[model samples]
Target: MSLPAPETPLYNHPLPQLERWLMALGCQQDRGDRHCWLLHQGDWDAELSLDTEELVICYFPHQPQRKVVRSFKYSLSRQDVEAAVLEGP
Candidate 1:
C-alpha cells in the first residue's frame, strides 16, 4: 500500500505501511516476535520494537557492555523518526 507523506505523523499510517517503511530501511522483522525488528550496519546493530504507544530502539554496544535505548512517540512525523533513527546512537 502507498504511504502517507513523510511529513505526516506516524499514527496516520496504516500498520502495514509502517512495516513496509521499516523494511525499506533495511530492517528485518524478528521471526519470533512480530512487533520487533532488527537492523545491522557495518559498525552497529539495533533492535526496534513497536510498543503500544511508541517505537523503541536499542542500539548494541553504545559502550562496551551497554546498549543505548531510545523511544519515539507515534505522534511524531514519519520523517522526523526516520531521520533520528537513521542518524544512529
Candidate 2:
C-alpha cells in the first residue's frame, strides 16, 4: 500500500501547536474568553490576551493569585503564551 501525501498547513498553526506545547509543559487552560485565555502552570499563572492582531502575554507578577471574572480581547501566539505561562520574568 502507498502512503497518502501529507496535508498542507492552513494559515498559521500557532494555537494547535501552542496547545500541544502547553500540555507537554503541564500547563492547563483554566479558562478562556473570545480574545484571552487563562493558563495554570504549576504554581504560576498567566493571562494571555489577544489585542488588535497580536498575542500579548501579561504576567501577574504576584504569585498565588486567584482567577477572577474578567474578559478582554487578545491577539497572541500560542508559542508566546506557552513560554510566558511556563517561564517568567
Candidate 3:
C-alpha cells in the first residue's frame, strides 16, 4: 500500500503557492524584492512582506495619517491573512 504524504500547513505553504494566493487578490511582486509585494484597488494600495515568522502588511504606503501596519503569524490560515490584509484600516 502506498502511504499519503503529510499535509502542509497554510503558513508553511510553498513560495509559489504564496505568490499565487497574493496574485489572486490583485497583488504583484515588487521589482526590487521577491519577498515584497504590492496590491492596488481603486485609490488604496498596500505593501506586504513575507518574513520568517510573520507576514507584515502596510496599508496606505505614503500617507502616514491614513496608514496602517499589521503583522500576522505564519500559523494563521491563508483566508485569515487575506481577510485581514484586504480589509482596509
Candidate 4:
C-alpha cells in the first residue's frame, strides 16, 4: 500500500503503511521484536522502537559511553518526524 501525504500525521497512518515507510527509509525490523527497528547510515547507526504513544530512537555511540535518544509523538506530521529523525541526533 502507498503512504499518505508527507504532511499527514503519523497517527493517521495504518500500521502497514507505517512499516512500509520505515522500510523505505532503510530501517530493518528486528527479528525478535517486531516493534523494534535498526538503521545504519554512513556514519551512524540507530535503534528505533515503535511504542504505543511515540516513535523512539537511540543513536549509538554519542560519546563513547552514551547514546542519544529522542522520541516523536505520533501526533506529529510524518514529514516533520522524518526530517527530525532522519536528520540524526
Candidate 5:
C-alpha cells in the first residue's frame, strides 16, 4: 500500500512565490502591511491576511455586517488557499 505525502504549509511557500501567485490572481499587497493584501474585481473587494497560524480573509470591506471572514490553516496547499481567496463571499 502507498501513503500520500504529508501536506505542506502555506507559510512554507517562499514570499516571492506567494507574491507571484497573488499577483497572477489580481491581488495587490497592502502598502501599510506586507502581511496583508487586497483584491478587487468589479464591485467585490476583499482583504487577505497572513497570520502566524492561519490565512484570514475578509470579503466586502464596505459592508461590515455582511462581510465574510474565513480562516484557513497555514498547513494547506497553495491551490487550496488560492481557491478560497478567489471564491470571495
Candidate 6:
C-alpha cells in the first residue's frame, strides 16, 4: 500500500504522506502519542527520525549531533533526501 514509485523523483512531499510512508517502512515508535518515529536499517547502519516539525537522519558511524535536518515539509523520497542530504531535527 505504498505510493511514489521507487524510480519517481521527489521535490517535496506533504508531511502526512511522508509520515504514512515512514510508518509502512517499519519506523519504530519513539513517541507514538506525539508523532515522533524512528526507522533503523542495520544494513545501512542509519537511523531516521521524524515528527511534526522536523526530520533527522543520523549516521551511526559519524559523530553525534551530526544528523541531517529538514523542514517538516521536506519530501521523504530518496531523491529528495539525497538532494537535500540528511537533515537535522
What CA root-mean-square deviation does each model show from the true structure?
A: 1.4, 8.1, 5.3, 1.4, 5.8, 5.5
Query: All candidates' lDDT scores?
Result: 0.93, 0.46, 0.77, 0.91, 0.76, 0.51
TM match of model 4 to true structure: 0.93
Q: Model 5, stretches more than 4 Å misplaced? A: 1-9, 61-65
- Over 1-89, each residue of candidate 5 has an lDDT whose tens digit, in order, gives 22123245576777676667677788899998999989996657988887878888888855455888999997788777777777778
Scored against the true structure, residue 57 in model 1 reaches a CA lDDT of: 97
**Candidate 6 local lDDT, 1-89, one digit each (tens):** 35666445343455576666666666655664445565555433345655444555555433455444344234445456544433323
Score candidate 2 by lDDT: 0.46
Candidate 6 TM-score versus the reference: 0.42
- Candidate 3 per-residue C-alpha lDDT over 1-89 given as tens digits, one digit per residue, 9 for 90 to 100: 22112243456677787787778789999988989999986656888998988999888854456788899887787767777787766
Enumerate residue pairs that collide in model 5: none
TM-score winner, 1 or 6: 1
Model 1 lDDT tens row, 1-89: 78899999999988999999999999999999999999987667899999999999998854576788999999999999999998888
Q: Which candidate's lDDT is highest?
A: 1
Question: Candidate 1: worst 10 consecutive residues by lDDT?
Answer: 59-68
Per-residue error (Å), model 5, residue 50: 1.1
lDDT-best of 4 and 5: 4
Candidate 3: TM-score?
0.80
TM-score of each: 0.93, 0.41, 0.80, 0.93, 0.77, 0.42
Can you tell me which runs of candidate 1 are displaced by over 4 Å?
Answer: 62-65
- Runs off by more than 4 Å, candidate 3: 1-9, 61-64
Clashes of 3: 0
Kindly indicate the candidate among 4 and 6 with the higher TM-score. Answer: 4
Report residue 77 deviation for candidate 4 (angstroms).
0.7
